[model samples]
Target: MKILLTGISGQVGWELQRSLMSLGNVIYMGRNQLDLSQPDTITTTIRDIKPDLIVNPAAYTAVDKAESEIDLAMAINGVAPGIIAEEAKRLNAAIIHYSTDYVFDGNQNTPYRESDLTNPQNVYGKTKLVGEEAISSIGVNHIIFRTSWVYGLRGKNFLLTMQKLAREREEIKVVDDQIGSPTWSRMIAEITAQIVAKFQQNPSDFFSNKGGIYNLSPSGKTSWYGFAKAIFNDDFSNNERKLQRLIPITTQEYPTPASRPAFSLLDNQKLSDTFGLKIPEWDQALKLVLDS
Candidate 1:
């Protein structure tokens, strides 16, 4: 099978290169090759490749910057998926796209479900939701895996930011109000490959029954401060860094251009029940990321 994978330079996309190798010939494309910002180029590139399955991990992922760049964000995150979905439908191919937990307003006391009413609080979230709607409305075999608090060894993420800050600064202040599971990007890609393998093995029944959205995140939730503490304490379990302090602060104290969800945790029971897959706990996953 031929698979067209976008966003190969990104955190999830970078790991997908290794995880998806066994599945098929992955035609990976980074920004220079498959720019989601350019709609016509997106269609042209997908058509040119004519992949059996299109896996889009690309998006306008700058949460704060998106507040000022609405049009660009929408073009990439909102409009691109529909265009790709239409092309996929034309070729009778399947699509697997990644989404964010920010699609919800994040006010719910419990973990957000796939069927929850979406009320995005920021432009980034709003655009991502638009992408989800676009693909769903296009009537193609698709799987929207909405994940949260994604971090990895590579890329600009909370884990890397903390590692940098801890070394340079003596004290680190993290927002404690916002809460979500810190899912490793590698796990997301591997799980997706497993899903794709299943579909390739049984296309008719999988799409006929299981073609829709699913929450793909780690098992538990934690505040930014909690995650930072884990990073420091775990990473420095043997070695040394700043060897310093962590101050937990409220969201109001640290304001950003884009408003984030207070609690963006997602329930992954649906994904687990459907795929018989489960990510390790937040702390355990962090240890794994740090160790290997």
Candidate 2:
């Protein structure tokens, strides 16, 4: 199988390169090579590659900065996926796209399901929702995985930020109100590869019958404060960072341009039942991330 992957530089994309290589020949492309902002470029790239599967992990992921850069965000996150879906439809290639938990407003008390109503609070969420809508409307063979709190060793993510802060600062304050699972990008890539392998084995069953949005996250949830504390505790045996000193603050105190979901935990039962794959607990994945 020939697979075309976008966003080679991203956390998930970088990991996907390894996971996807086992399945078949993998062609990785960065923004410079396949530039999602340009519909013509996306079309040309797809035509040239003619891949059997297209994995799109590229996105405009600056949650706070997206408020001021709506046009840029929408183009890359919203419109680009739509164009890719259209091209995929033409080529009869299956698409795998990554979405975010920000698609829903954080009003619900329980974990969000695949069928939950999406009412994004910020521009970033709205744009991601638009991308999901575009894929759904195109009526093609696609699977949209809506994940939360993604972090990896290579990218500018929460884990890296916490690691940096813990090394330099005496004390760090993290938001305690916002709650979600800290999904490792490597896990996401592994799950994507598993799904692809399944498809390769039974293409007709995988594409014709089962293809829709599924919430892909770890089993448990944690606040930003708890997550940071866990990171410090797991990494430093001497406790130099002093996890106890890591202060917990409310979201109100740490103000940003975008309003974060108070709780963005996603229910993974649907994904597990559909794919026959169990998501590891956030703690289990956190250890692997720290080890790396």
Candidate 3:
């Protein structure tokens, strides 16, 4: 199979290169090659490649910065997805897109399901939801894996931020109220590869009854503070950081322009039922990333 992948420089995309190598002839494209902001560019590139599958791990993920870059965010996160879906439909190809848990407001006490109502509280979430809608509306064979708290070895994510802060400052203050699964990008890529391989074996069976939005977060959830502590304790040997203390603070104390969901835990039962894949808990996955 010929595969076209976007966002080759992102955390998940970086790992996807390794995970998807054995699947087929993989073509990797960064923004310079196939800029999502330009619909014409995306159309030209995808048509030229004519891939059997399109895997989109690229997204405008700046939560707070998206508030100021609404047009760019919408173009990439909202409009670009529809463009890709349209092209994929023409080529009789399938797509696997990654979305986020921010689509819902933090009102539910339990984990969110695929059918949960989406009321994005921030611009980033709203735009991502638009992407999901665009792909689904196209009626193409697709799987939208909505994950949360994604981080990896190389990326401007919470893990790297906390690791840097731990080394630079003696005390680190993190928000204690906001909660998520803290998924590793490598895990996401690996699971995606597995699903793709499975789909290749039975395309009709997979897309007929199983293609849809499925929560792909780690099994367990934790506050930002707890997540940071896990990183220090599990990721580091001998606690070898300059961090002396970790202060748990409220979201109000460290306000940002983008509003965050207080609890954005996603339920992964549908994923298990469909793909027979159940991601491990946050702590377990963190160890795998750190060890690698």
Candidate 4:
């Protein structure tokens, strides 16, 4: 099988390079090769590749910056996905897209199910939701995996930010009120590969039955403060720590351009039931990443 993977420089995409090779001949594209913001470029590139499977991990992920760069964000995160889906439909190829937990407002206290109503609180979430809707509306063979609090060794995520601040500052203040799972990008890639393997086994059956949105995240959840503590606690690195204290603060104390959901924990029951995959806990996944 010939597979086209986007966002080679991203955390998930970087890891996907390693995981997806076993399934097929993977043609990976970084931002320079296939810019999602350019509609004609996206069309031309995908048409040239003519892949049987298109896995899109590329997205405009700057939450705060998206507030100012509305058009760029919408183009990459919103409009680009629809364009990709259209091309995939033309080729009769399957798509695996990544989405976020921010699609829903944090009104409910319980973990969010796949069937829950979405009410994005910020521009980033709104754009991601648009992407998800576009993929679904295209009526293509697709799986929209809604993940949360994604971090890996290579990306500028919360885990790396906390590690950097730990070295530079004595005290680190993190928001404790906002809660979600801290998923390792590698795990996301591996799970995606497994899904693709299943699709490979019986493409038509899988597409006809299991082609929709599924919450793909670790089993447990935590606040930013808790995640920081966990990172420091599992300090497997050789570098010396300069952090004296890790302080917990509320969301109001630390203001940002984007309005974050207070709780965005996604329920993985649907994904588990459908895929027969046992997901690791958030802390366990964090340990595996830190150890690596």
- Give all TM-scores, in the order shown: 0.97, 0.96, 0.97, 0.98
| Candidate 2 structure lDDT | 0.92
Model 3: CA > 4 A from native: 234-240
Q: What is the lDDT of residue 208 in candidate 4?
A: 86
For model 1, the run of ten residues with the poorest summed lDDT: 234-243
Give the per-residue lDDT digits (tens) of candidate 4, residues 193-282.
Answer: 999999999987788899999999999889999999899994535367678878899999999999999999999999999989999999
- Candidate 1's displacement at residue 87, Å, is 0.3
Model 1 regions more than 4 Å off: 234-240
Clash numbers, per candidate: 0, 0, 0, 0
| Residue pair clashes in candidate 3 | none
lDDT by residue (1-292, candidate 2, tens digit) is: 8999999999999999999998999999998898887888998899999998999999999999999999999999999999999988998889999999999999999999999899999999999999999999998899999999999988899988887777677678899999899999999999999999999999976877779999999999899988988887744545555333578899989999999999899999999998899889999999987776
Who wins the lDDT comparison? Answer: 4
lDDT per residue (tens digit) for residues 1-292 in model 3: 9999999999999999999989999999987888999999999999999999999999999999999999999999999999999999999999999999999999998999999999999999999999999999999889999999999999799999998887778888899999788989988999999998998898776787789898998898899999998888734434557778888999999999999999899999889887777668889989887787
Q: Which segments of candidate 2 are over 4 A away from where they belong?
A: 234-244
> Which lDDT value does model 4 have at 132?
96
The per-model lDDT (C-alpha) reads 0.91, 0.92, 0.92, 0.94
- Candidate 2: RMSD over Cα atoms? 1.6
- Worst ten in a row by lDDT for model 4: 234-243
